[model samples]
Target: MGYAQLVIGPAGSGKSTYCSSLYQHCETVGRTIHMVNLDPAAEHFSYPVSTDIRELISLDDVMEELGMGPNGGLIYCMEHLEDNLDDWLDEQLDGYLDDDYLVFDCPGQIELFTHVPVLRNFVEHLKRKNFNVCAVYFLDSQFVSDVTKYISGCMASLSAMIQLELPHINILSKMDLVSNKKDVEEYLNPEAQVLLSQLNRQMAPKFGKLNKSLAELAAHVFQMSMLSLLFPAKSMA
Candidate 1:
């Protein structure tokens, strides 16, 4: 049973940086962790990849030859990867032993995680291969400072959680760069009562009744017992 982290986030949200830092952290603690570059459009990276998806298909090659834009080309490249999972991905993963720790540095495409079945199918393939995979969803720490943005981030995380049906871990990345950590840290493990108060303050007076309902809903959703809690209910087994 191999352990794997599917590092994912919106573009420029530090998925790659998180992977690099995590890799370094593992090294400092005398642990072995292999990183696989799953971003075909990635031009640079801090960590060396054990296996690269670009070898099978690249956005540059797809775009230059097929005349697709950057986004479309990357989607095409990922779709191509999905098609070759049994062949190319299998060949690359064959070298790693069971119980190996792998970090897949995936593309920063939001659509891939939100609604697309490509990544979902890819994860299913990993499970079939006996990998205990965790989806580490990173959000820029700056975005969570405000109540509205925090809610949006939470919803996005929730969407991914429901879509993939995996053990999800939501990470507020780039914490070191946050100057006003106090404001942001408050939202990390926010209480339902606090969220309700914040929502009431942010909404208009005309929406007082609506805000109350929204607050109750938000509170219910954020409760520890909620089925769709953004935070994973239990430790990964």
Candidate 2:
């Protein structure tokens, strides 16, 4: 069976950079991997793309023709992709061997992963093609610096996990940019009580119940094996 990683995150969260880094790392380790560009709006890529959705549908062409904005055009591009999956995606998959590993650098639209059925259908299509797929979600490491932001990130990740229903891997990207590693580490493997106390301190007493509930949920998500803290410095090494 083939192996695939669905690399997804918000815009500017470093999804493309991570994919490029991963490709370089695999090359150094003498492992072969194919990169697939799923972002219709992607202008350039550091890594060579084995398969590109832009070949089938482009955001620029869609926006210019349909007179849609970036967000709407992106959604339109993805929907168009979904419609042609059987024909276009199947032909692309045929180029690779059954054992080949593919990394799909997806668009950064949060709506696509959270509520849309596009990604879910894409994953199912991969499965039908005998590929084991896992979603690698990236969150900006700076979000961990604040208790409220940390909770928001966790909720977003959790939403994707629930929506995609895949073997999920949450990655906190841009660790190298973080100033205080100690502060970030706490939330990496946080305890329920610790997070609750921190949340309580950050918010007013009026938000006590909301803070406690959020902390517990965040703590549970952090404890899962799927949630991994990737340090880019060591990851590239």
Candidate 3:
């Protein structure tokens, strides 16, 4: 009935910017989409928001009222959102038609998507609402320049894929800022052996086995779990 893209990534990975670009693209093509702000800590937006979770709970309010740190406040805000999904979120969904498309701009907290149950529960809620959901994860193009960083990014993406249990897309964001595009392209769809060789050269010989295993796992994750790698520059252009 409905379609949704859960835009998630680490801090500074350009989730909001991606959402704004997507909104503009859809507008240009004469397609309608609702951009929902799921990040309670978010202060500004370049695109119009159809639904906002900050209406229910906000990290700033939580931190000020409960005397909690930023991380703790974010977790608290998300948990509060989970608690009100049946009420607040359901009400928000009721405003849109069954065929409407929505883009949820989520927080940059890595733990929320990886090991936490909050986002999983949110996804389940969307399913119950008869919405087909897909996760669009972003990684900064700059972050994957080295073998180790590439492996780390792959692992994080894989973790979110397993945890979310939805059709997943990995996007390398901020490609416009990558001066040497070839360096970032190699990690986009690299061979497992190539990654292992690079890792072996960078890491100590004692870490050879670990490096090989990591490279293989990264390759497997990309080949199997990830639907595809998207470059923001090309996609938005």
Candidate 4:
């Protein structure tokens, strides 16, 4: 069976960079990992794309032909991908051996991973083709500095975990940019009570109930008992 990492995250969360790093990492370890460019709108790429969806459909072509904006054209491109899965994606993936590992560098669209069924359905296709798939969701480390933002990140990750129904790994990216390492150290395997306290100190007391709920959700999400995985990267210093 094929092993695959479905890399996804919000825009500027380093999804492509992660793929590039992982690719280089695999090369250093003498491992073979192919990258698939799933984003039709992707104009430039850092990693060598082993297979590309643009071979089948392209966002620029869609936008120019349909007069659709970026958002609309991207959605159209994704829907077109879904429709062509049986024919196009299957054909592309079939070229690889069963044991080949593939990293799918998806579009940095949060909604595509959190709520959209397009990717969910795509994963199902991979499973049918005997792929052992894992979803690696990335969030910006800078965005998680504040308590409220951290809680929101947790919820967003939890939503993707439940929605994808695949092995999930959450990564906090851009650790290299965080100057204050102390601020980040406190969040590693953070305690629910401590998180609530931090939020209380950051926001108005009137938001206490909201903070409590968010904290509880984050606790449940981060709890060792949960299947959800958390990965925090240190600055590459």
**C-alpha lDDT of all candidate models, in order:** 0.79, 0.89, 0.90, 0.83
lDDT by residue for model 2 (1-237), tens: 999999998898889888889999999999999999999999998889999999999999998999999999999999999999899999999999989999999999999999999999999999999999999999888777877888888898899999999988888888988899897887878888998898888789999899889988888887785457664523364
**Which stretches in model 1 have alpha-carbon errors above 4 Å?**
204-237
- For model 2, the stretches where C-alpha displacement exceeds 4 angstroms are 233-237
TM-score, candidate number 4: 0.91
Per-candidate clashes, comma-separated: 0, 0, 0, 0
* Candidate 3 structure quality by residue, lDDT tens digits, 1-237: 999999998998989888888899999999999999999999999899999998998889999999999999999999999999999999999999989999999999999999999999999999999999999999998888888899889889989999999988888887888889898878767788999999998989999899888988988877774625655644363
Candidate 3 segments exceeding 4 Å error:
225-227, 233-237
Pick out the ten consecutive residues of candidate 1 with the lowest summed lDDT: 228-237
Clashing pairs in 1: none
Which ranges in model 4 have alpha carbons more than 4 Å from their true place?
Answer: 202-206, 225-237
Lowest lDDT sum, 10 consecutive residues, model 4, at: 228-237
| Candidate 1: tens digits of C-alpha lDDT, residues 1-237 | 888889887887878877777788788888999999999999988887999998899999999999999999988998999999999998988899997999999898888998988899999999999999889888887787877787777777777888888887777766666778897868756676677678878887787776566555544545533222222111222
What TM-score number comes out for model 1?
Answer: 0.86
Highest-scoring model, lDDT: 3
What's the lDDT for residue 56 in model 4?
A: 85
CA RMSD, predictions in order = 5.0, 1.7, 1.8, 2.7
